[model samples]
Target: MHVPDGFINAPVSAVAGVVAAGAVAVSLRGARKELGGASRSAASGGERTAPLAGLVAAFIFAVQMLNFPVGAGTSGHLLGGALAAILVGPYTGVLCISVVLLMQGILFADGGLTALGVNITVMGVVTTVVAYVLFRGLTGILPRTRRSATVSAFIAALVSVPAAACAFTLIYAVGGTTDIPIGKVLTAMVGVHVLIGIGEAVITALTVGAVIAVRPDLVHGARSLAVPLKLRIDGELVDAPVAAPAPVAARSTRTVWSVGLVTAFVLAGFVSFYASASPDGLEKVAADKGIDAKAEEHAAADSPLADYGVRDVTDTRLSGGLAGVIGVGATVAVGSGVFWVVRRRRQDEPADARVTETV
Candidate 1:
């Protein structure tokens, strides 16, 4: 959900700005560990997965362009908040979605710049925390099957939307510009988001399930609970016994980069045309509750790429499609670059005794 400028009051927005800044700071540090550690961990038979993380972010960005009809006049897209956090890690996932929000706000004018902090907080932080908590809790008590990962993905995303809605309501209650009834805002916001949450759940579960099927080792949320990979010996499957450890395989990173960039281009260029053209969760709530009365027009409204249309491209479909493609390409490039740096930094660490001695 992209919160416009007028929904939350000044003081609350300022506070949220600080909170969002802090969250981003923490995420930057945490992302270094997650991306780098995962890269190092992949030194074994485990597959290289950092580029998959970037691809996951790019995929989330593309899918979010399509908003499915929820109810009444409102529509919602895949939140991807929970899905990203689960697939990658929480910190990296937050960075992924924050990048998407930044692009949408500045380039497409989909969200407000003044309200960027709020959008990041409610959507990124709230969803990640809530989903991660629930996922961990459920995975702890339930079986460690891929089904658990899928089920957790569904439920975690389901709850995250409304939790964000409630958080916005609370913020509005504290800093609402209008005198709208708190009860009305709360009811409307929560109700609409509940529907939006369904869309989020389906999308998150499907994406998570798909990734788990292909590369369960890459999913950060499901990492701890994964059953150890085994080899079939004498027609019976058993965990591969640890012996004198073999040298870590050095796979080419080129394939990961190529595949990620290609997929991002395809989704944004070709697939986004079919996305539903309805207002998202935040836009719908603002209209329904009079929260948008004082909304400020976006400063970048006249940008060449405003509204997801390419500059000087007269064809509506082509312009929008090209813009989407460009946006995806930019996001993937930037995201992969950041993650690659993090991964490389990890690789640069003082060689550990285990690796140094072996080498």
Candidate 2:
């Protein structure tokens, strides 16, 4: 849920900001190892995390626009934390979501700029930490088949959405701007988001399964937990040793990247038009319970791409489509740039660190 301005008091908002900033700082350093292939862990065998992480960010931004209805006139979008953390590492996943939230706030004016820290903390950190931890736990306990990993993704995503709802409820209990009863808010938020979590779970499961089917090596959550690939010899099945990671430059993810980028553009540009128009879980809870009584207008309300439409375009389809396309392009560009830098930092680290990770 994207917490808008005025929902939280300035002091709490500032505190959340500092907390979110610290999280981002920590994630930045952690992501270097993930993105740099220091771990040599890709489900697709030799794929690198940097490119996939960028696509994951862009894909999350695109899929988020396609809000599926969760009944009771409430709609929900993909938070992408579970999906990202499963596809990439938790640290890099945090960065991916932060990038999406940042773009949405500054460009499309979806999330409030002032409440950005709240959004990042609840949506990014809380969701990622909760989902990844659960996914790891479940995968560890279950059979080490690819199906088990996919099942873990489903369960992890299912729990993460409501966990985030609970987190927001706690935050609201502390700093809510309205006079609504905290108990009612908590019940309503969790109830609606539980339904929303189903939607999130389905999406997360399908996406994780698809990636694992083709590029299991590319999936971070599936890494090491995966069963060895079996090749049938003349008369029997034989386990094949894992292939060494290809040199970074020699590994080409162009096919996957191209397909993912195209899918993102198509979803954001055209498919988004069919998304349910009803308010999402948080918006519905806030409106029905009077929590948004003091909400402020988005500061970027006047931007050219505000509200996912072009400023001067008269045709609704064309305007929204163009805005969506621009958003995808911008998100991919910025995400790739950020990951590139993170990966570079890993390469620049003292040679011993690489040896340590490799060992």
Q: Who wins the TM-score comparison? A: 2
In candidate 2, what are the lDDT values of residues 14-94, reduced to their tens digit? 999999999999999888778764444342332367888889999999999999999989999999999999998999999
When summed lDDT is taken over every stretch of 10 residues in candidate 2, the lowest stretch is: 38-47
Error of 1 at 161 (Å): 1.0
How do the residues 1-359 of candidate 1 rate in per-residue lDDT, one tens digit apiece?
A: 78877767777888999999999888877776677653356442223556766676678888888879987888988777898888888888888888788878887887788889998998889998888888888888889899988998899999999999998898888887788899998999899999999999998998788767765665788777656679999999999775654443345345544665676677778778887788887787788778888888887889999988988999988998899888887777777777787667666666683355336
The per-prediction tally of clashing pairs is: 0, 7
Which residue window of length 10 is worst by lDDT in model 1?
38-47
Off by over 4 Å in 2: 37-47, 228-252, 353-359
- Which regions of candidate 1 are displaced past 4 Å? 37-49, 228-261, 347-359
Query: Best lDDT goes to which candidate?
Result: 2
What root-mean-square deviation over C-alphas does model 2 reach? 3.2
